[model samples]
Target chain A: MEKRITFKGVWLPLALIAPQIVITAVFFFYPAGQAIWQSLFIPDPFGLSMTYVGLGNFEFLLSDPFYRASFVTTAIFSTLVTVVSMGVALFLAVLADRLIKGSGTYRTLLIWPYAVAPAVAGVLWLFMFNTRVGVITWYLGQLGYDWNHVLNENEAMGLVVVASAWGRISYNFLFFLAGLQAIPRSVIEAAAIDGARFWTRFRTIVFPLLSPITFFLLVVNVVYAFFETFGVIHTITSGGPQQATTILVYKVYSDGFVGQDLGSSAAQSVILLALVALLTVIQFKFIERRVHY
Target chain B: MVEKRGAGLWLTHVGMIIGVAFIFFPIWLAFVASTVEQQAIVRPPMPLLPGDKLVENYTRALTSGVNAPVATMLFNSAIMATGIAVGKIIISLLSAFAIVYFRFPGRQIFFWLIFVTLMLPVEVRIVPTYEVAANFGMLNSYSGLILPLIASATATFLFRQFFMTVPSELAEAARVDGARPMRFFFDILLPMSRTNIAALFVILFIFGWNQYLWPLLITTDPSMNTIVMGIKQMFPSGDDTADWPVIMATSLLAMIPPVIVVISMQRLFVRGLVDSEK
Candidate 1:
């Protein structure tokens, strides 16, 4: 939407935009273009020259068992993180929404977790579940269940998922609470007057109304699980126990920085770029439609 | 108000308390761990209550961390977060004002260019981006930490969204008074955008503070480490147990600034978070 009245000086406007344009071009566009370009070339091991392989890196990455496992691992990891965080958040939001008053007090209690960094959240959870001194792990041992995420694949995945989702709960809770509050009270009342119980009213009327925000949160939580959980995975398990918890982003980091396989990492990055682009498209299209409904 | 939830109301309160407790348990344990000595923590099933060593542990953390003082890491974090937050706000305000208020050539192209940065997070293009930064000699510098990430167009889109709602008559009246484009921007638009700027500042501050991978890659210097990423470095590399007390204290300290910002600016923080979707 253009402003009806706008200033007419081309150079002045161009001057105003120059900083943003230059920074975006240099930092964002150039690097992204280079990722695409680098995906086609293989660099020699000595950090010297590059060979034009032309899709060789992509082919190798697609076929590598480890890379393929990372894909599956990422899928499972993101799904679990999204589900766990969203489920807990929805539960909290519903309970809070049901409060006659003092939801704000509960909100204040719950949402401070939002302020904790994802990496810090990992440390917090890691402390609780730390193999040696972890209070929770010690308690679990009392229950006769051995808990060692460092050496166990499933346990490591679980720890990373929970740690990543821990801080995320607040974000989902805020949105869910907002969504719940935005549902007109009259509709629920109408359902109640028609002899609909609370559960019935929620499932039939309230849930439908909240679907737009639900969908929005789903996409957002998935993205959070995708890119932002790098800290959680890195700190908690280091994507370990045989790369069980290594998501796509972690693999990108590990390969690019640790392994120094620039070509394959660049290819993975290009694939990830495509993934994010697709997610962005899906978000805009679905969210725009849902909001209109 | 739909129906008197009478007994159900009490149940809701109870459930919420449980949910809140479950969420708070981790931080609570961290705090408890921070207060205790190392032996108390390592022996399994550490005392749940705060120990008398609170001051001692926190003092140790602030004065002398493993590699560098936690105080120094905190200082670096504050600089990085504030720099990124303030820098992005200035650039975004300018570009957004120009986009919304001017009829310039290539405006569409510029908008789309800024918009595209949203999809390309630093994680994806780490290698090449690092190479770019290295080429520019940005490593271990504050500018290196802030500049690349500031290119995001979130606040720009937000300003544009708000500007569309602003009455054109405001700009029209300003023009009649013989105000230049930038003068109108400074005199009228800047003041009008105060709440937005404040709200975005709250959110962006947290974003900047929580950064992990970028700071991890760029700042190999111990003194330059931000607290969020620096905590992981405190963990022992091999055999030795972590320094639980100091590490936990550092964890809580790392959280304090952002938590204080969010609680103090709760209303604005929430507004910024919801609005940041653009």
Candidate 2:
């Protein structure tokens, strides 16, 4: 990665990098190291002493039914958010890509929602689904269907998933549209000349060619669903309705901050740290592959 | 793109319109709710069109929210967002400059050190990070909100990537002209990085503005709240019903800045989006 020519000086380079190194060491490494350290020690109720439990915290978390449920919840939430957002985005991108005019208008109209925070998105969805005053709840009531996210686990999960996925559509759409545009027009036209209809051409040629982007978006979306959706979950369900929406990140927060089970939360944090590290490695590998392409 | 014009084209347009409409409906409704009176929204079947109470609701939110004034929260959010965006850009620029422009002792180690921060997010390290912030007496301060969040390696990585691609001849030429390192960076390199910096600023501003967990943790005082996290606080805690119009107004206010940035500088936003992920 080095350039052939470079500037000289040991202290000068150190001086340049000093601020970032200090911030990284103080804020990034220190807390991360503390999380790992704290995970191995069980603090007393008195908050004055700590007893080292080695891997006991991890063992307990693995056995805990609620923590296990949260794992399942995280899996379900991440999968649903990823699938829904990407599916809708790919569909819209295909539609937009088919247009010879007004695509820019459509892109503008579609992409602004990317700026809406997940928490704000959650609020928007919650306003629609709130049990007492929600407009959707009222409409559903007319059809003799009851809706209350604060009470029902399925409804809560459904709301959070939709809220999380909604704003994500804009991001996924932009990428998909970019990806679709990059596909060779000649290849698709050739498929058309071979008498393939739109769907057939898309399936046989476009989708296969787009798989790299699809895979990239898939991994990226999962990472988003895992980490960034904290706002959505926090604002809407708050891992509530009997913890139906408590994903791993939320569990870590609730355990440490709310529940004050420091060791358990730290253990969960370490686990999440590992999860992020693994996903990041996968993303880097994919990026390297794309560079080769 | 294929230049097809037929019923299929019409259908495609209709499908695209529906998708766009579906995307806009929630935001439209939220906007409508923000403009309407509380009773109008609290009642079933809120009006689809905007109401005349827009100014009233917005002013109410700005002046006296349930927790803190919306104006205060907005100001706090702006400061934190700008602080984060500017702070990260400056430090990352320096570090990336050091790593790419110099081959000093521990260069590789510093590069890897910054690089590995990508593996952990603020959300993962929430509790301990909060503890660290609290210990530093940064609680309820802008520094607490911005500093910990900016420690991520992305901007550094992005800048490093961009620096690597710059022609090495420029540096050699600068040296031949007797320009020192800092002088070269300021007079030459900084000018070259204008687009990248602008793009990164847009994205990072949004990232910082939209932050939820860190602000939620650090800002115990309602006055310290950023608008993004402040909206939730406006909801009544007990049996008291929410003031929907004000809350909705605050939501709109919170989103407007970043949305404007994204829409106005869209080309740069897209470029930054693609480049940063890589």
Candidate 3:
């Protein structure tokens, strides 16, 4: 049924699309262009002089040990957090799928964490892990373990990873649960009749079926671990205990806003953007083929 | 076979119980902490039981500083979420309608554009977005906070996916009866898409309300802050101890709207997912 495009149809779409293009141009494209432009020049805050430093910002980043360390921390943090969180979320989703009663209650309660704003979640967790007054700190003290996130680099990284994982599990669980429920019970019954064990059934049948959902979560979780932990890192550790938690996005924030090094900050942002884009391209090009859907 | 099936179900139940407990523990701790006094909160052995200071905490959190009046912050958050919800739905509906119904010149390109934007997180473009808002003199204004985010790629994508499922015969019948495109969309399509709209609304509302980085960058004035910003400010710097009770109180308060929406629309979400699959 080939429908002819009418005057009203054409005009209405143009009218509706105008605002989106305008807003995207102003807010997304223009600012992105400016950030790229600013990355090339060092702007003196005190002297109010802008000087061209072709590749100097990137060169400075490569030369500086602190900036180099930040890349390592971000890579380790994002990879480890994404794997661990997705693993736990998948486990929880499969478990929840088999529940015959109170499934809705469990789903609602489990997803409650996603409702807590990231900033507030950071504050809440930081309060719990505080050396003097934190509940977790007190519990650790009872076991004769000196647990201070402020002083211990390993503990600080652990705290950030755990907080990031906990904060995001709900969203992953939602998708995984949906994926799990979509699998047919008849297929499971047939697999069981063929003498397959629970583990065998899941690994051979369910896991393969849930691959697309898992892949989607993997991409989201990776992006989140890279960028979304800014508020958490800022509030909890301030990239402290020897800058152990200063990931790329946080570095960009500190360099640009707090440290007033706009050029360096812009350079860091470009690096972050490039890293994310590469991951996205890889996921779409290679990994997406393996997705069952 | 029956006995083995029962055992497997029991094991799954146990795993789910533990999983549910792990998820809820932090929220439970937050609620307990909110009820305690500041002194008790900072003690070496932190208080686990609910304290008698919930009211005092609420009072202090409500009247802390000149920056965010509790009522005003709530109002601002509400306005931002509502505006985004209405704006996103309208734009997404119109755009989705155009892509699904009208065979335009750049329809496929437009569709791909929205999908590409889905992968482009705000973190990448935030610096420039800040500059854009500044240029337009939208800093510290609601327009800055709401307008930039109103055209969500996720919403547009979701609507396009859902709209594709609607039978073209319905639109054909409407057009045959002398109904124009806009009239066909309004009269024939919208009523049928109430469920998808409701689900998308809840999702978009939650996202809009939870926005932090962009809003923080653009809104400098304390009075213009959202609930998340208000909570962040409650954490005092330097040697000054943060008041835990007030922080927890405000945190719990900030969570209420999203919680309410999620609970109320839980059935709708599940139903919509099922229907969309079909």
Candidate 4:
């Protein structure tokens, strides 16, 4: 995609790009290279020497119970967060799209939460479910259901997932609404004129048309759950309640910083790097195909 | 119009209202809690309505409350967010200009190098990046907080995509007028990119302000903490009751800037979000 007409200035262009290149090289590439390089070596407890053991860290992570558990936790956490957020967003977007008026008002009301930090969202939810003096918790006590995420593993996981999902609904909503509005009116009108019911029309036409955006949001939401929800987990549980809510990212932090297991944590990071690269490739590929449309 | 509706429209309205309420509930509760006294919150079934203690709690939070005063954290956050937004926009503008407007050596390689950074988020390289920052004595500094995270190429790619759509005749005219490359960039291209720069600023500002883990890792100093990460530090560890009112007040203050940006620039925020993701 070279421009038909371009300025001829080698030095100027190089200088223009130099800042970004330097930052990227120093902060981005250098650290990424280090993560890969460090994954194969284990540091002694004294911080005196490194042992070169190829594939040993990877092997240990694959078989380690906690690492395996983190993997499962990540899968469950990401899936639940993605499903809950996307489902709520899609439902809201559909209803908002159908409104003849006040959609913008609803949008304004709903979208500001996107600006709320994930950590703040976690704190807000935690405050409500605080077990003591928590309005929601106090109400649940009246219903004979004790709500305590502090000790309950599933409850802790559920709380973090919900908190993470709550902040993401606005982002998904915007994309879904845009996708819904992009559907040609005549196509939907044709379906309606053919005597299709609302649910039938939606399931047959609208849902199919929305698959692209849906798939895109799935990847985005998964990535969000993977990385961005660190704040949520940190504030609410700190991956506590017996490490039940510790997703892979949290594990990397805890093991590297807290546990001082550099080799295994670096291994986990390398795996995560690969996962993101794969997802980014898929996302870009989809964008490329969609560009034709 | 597709169809004029009565029952269905009412149902949609009901659904949308419920959705909006669900979205607003947590923040609304936080705001309510922020206004109430500590005892009012600690007691079960806190008042749902706004309390008269709003001024007292917020003032306490800003002036002399918490580990670090909320005011200081807010100032730190403001600086970090503004630095990240302005820095990212400036560098991205220059790089995007170069990519779109000039033919240069190692251009494609340089572009791909920037592109590759997009795939590796800060979380994956946290340990090594932290080590890098620590080695460079960048910890607890504003540059450390802002620089590493702004390495993303999303803004650059966005500007490049936009610049491609700009007609070549504009540049031709500038060249014919004897404008130098940078002179044309400053006088012509920059004016054209104002909307994009503004839109990207809104999104980047929110991103910078909402950052949690990086600041948490680097800025261990109480005075250096950003409000977003500082809120967690205010929480008590043991059975001791947290200053709920003050914490809630800090939460409200922490969110205000980003929320104001989003609401005031709703259109640009949405445009930047949609455009950047592409």
For all candidates, state DockQ relative to the true structure. Answer: 0.83, 0.82, 0.48, 0.81
Over 4 Å off, model 4:
none
Comparing candidate 1 with candidate 2, which one achieves the higher lDDT?
A: 2
lDDT of each: 0.90, 0.92, 0.77, 0.92
Tens digit of per-residue lDDT, candidate 3, span A1-293: 23343324566776666666566656666666788888899988783888999999999999999999998999899888898778888898877777767777788888787777777678778877888788888888889998988888999998888888888888778888888888888898889888898789999999999877677677778888988777778778888889899998887877777887888888877776677778778666644465343
Which residue runs of candidate 3 sit more than 4 Å off their true CA positions? Answer: A1-9, A46-49, A282-293, B1-11, B65-67, B103-115, B270-278
Candidate 1 chain B least-lDDT 10 residues: B1-10
Chain B TM-score of predicted candidate 2 relative to the true chain B: 0.98
Residue-by-residue lDDT tens digits, candidate 1, B194-251: 9999999999999999999999999999999999999999998998999999999999
Tens digit of per-residue lDDT, candidate 2, span A82-137 = 99999999999999999989999999999878999999999999999888888899
Per-residue lDDT for A1-293 in model 4, tens only?
A: 66777898799999999999999988899998999999999999988999999999999889999889999999999999999999999999999889868899999999988999999999999999998888889999999999999999999999999999999999999999999999998999999899988899899999999998999899999999999999999999999899999999999999999898898889999999999999999998999898987
DockQ order of candidates, top first = 1, 2, 4, 3
Worst 10 residues of 3 chain B by lDDT: B269-278
Clash count (model 1, backbone only): 0
Mind giving the per-residue lDDT tens digits that candidate 3 earns over B169-202? 7876777788887788788789988888998788
TM-score of each: 0.99, 0.99, 0.91, 0.99
Between prediction 2 and prediction 4, the one with superior DockQ is: 2
